[model samples]
Target: MDLPEIQSIDDLALLVEKLKLGLVSAATSDEYEFSDEEYKRIRKILLSNPMFTELIPSYLKLCRNLSGVWQYIKHEFSTYAERRGFHY
Candidate 1:
């Protein structure tokens, strides 16, 4: 299948959803938990993506080096100035 072009932030949001990472949420009260293996997978997948540098460079760097939980991603993505989730 052909992939859609990443021409806008909305496209990125759509792509992220399909990755199954979901929108991040802050751990202000409750934190989501993940297995050690899953955590490693997240880190590995994130660290390898260079496109993040073009979107939110600092935030992407933090996600690559410092993030540990799903909530952190949600919180970080919250900075995106558009409505999230699959729109179609």
Candidate 2:
């Protein structure tokens, strides 16, 4: 599928939705999370693809490494939930 140009937040959100579905489909197909080899291949693809560069800036991008980003996402969602009066 052709990726849409990410010129704004709405475009970016669409890209995110697409990515979410793709990842979910891949995980279901594999019956598990990505293996090391699969992860390496994915990394190679992202690194080589020019399309990803537009969505992420050089300084703010975290896809090169994702553990920190995962943690950050968790924290961000936790903060958001707190603001909305949601709790554990």
Candidate 3:
């Protein structure tokens, strides 16, 4: 399948939704994790598309942005499972 273009913050929001993100609490005795293989597969698919590969840096800054720019991405990530979905 073709990967969706995440060229902007809006696009990233949509991508987060499509991926069905959610959060989990680490305080509990039980913990969930996503395997390296699964992670690699998603990255592979994303990088498979030139658009996603080229825009990766911009996408990353959404988190690295210390000026509270990460809030947007953080909100999107709130819907993802703790340690389950994409990190950035």
Candidate 4:
């Protein structure tokens, strides 16, 4: 499935959730990998937003799976509070 346009932080969060589900499905079926093209698209979208710029580099390096991405987001922004702030 094609990714949706990320117009806000909420959009980004939704994309991440979709990616997580995709990753889980891929792992179970052993038939897919998150393509480099998809990563580039995601990177481009995030870099377009100043609020997400700080996350792109580390995220590119460390976010190979949902758990890694989740941990990084949680570690950098806390699990709940900072994420809630981003949405508002």
- lDDT of each model, Cα atoms only? 0.41, 0.43, 0.41, 0.55
Residues 1-88 of candidate 3: C-alpha lDDT, one tens digit per residue: 3555557777656544432221122111124453334334445555566666665545433323222323544555554343344442
TM-score of 3: 0.33
TM-score of each: 0.30, 0.36, 0.33, 0.40
Off by more than 4 A, model 1? 1-26, 35-40, 63-88
Worst 10 residues of 3 by lDDT: 21-30
Clashing pairs in 4: none
lDDT of 2 by residue, 36-79 (tens): 34433444444455777675434225534334334444564544
Clashes of each: 1, 0, 9, 0
Q: Kindly list the per-residue Cα lDDT of model 4 for residues 52-75, writing each as its tens digit.
A: 667655664556545565555566
| Candidate 2 error regions (>4 Å) | 1-32, 56-60, 79-88
RMSD of each: 8.9, 8.9, 10.0, 8.5
In order of lDDT, best first, we have: 4, 2, 3, 1
Which candidate leads the pack in TM-score? 4
Q: Which pairs clash in model 3?
A: 21-79, 21-80, 22-79, 22-80, 22-81, 23-80, 23-81, 23-82, 24-82
Off by over 4 Å in 4: 1-5, 18-30, 57-88
- Please give me the total number of clashing residue pairs in predicted model 2: 0
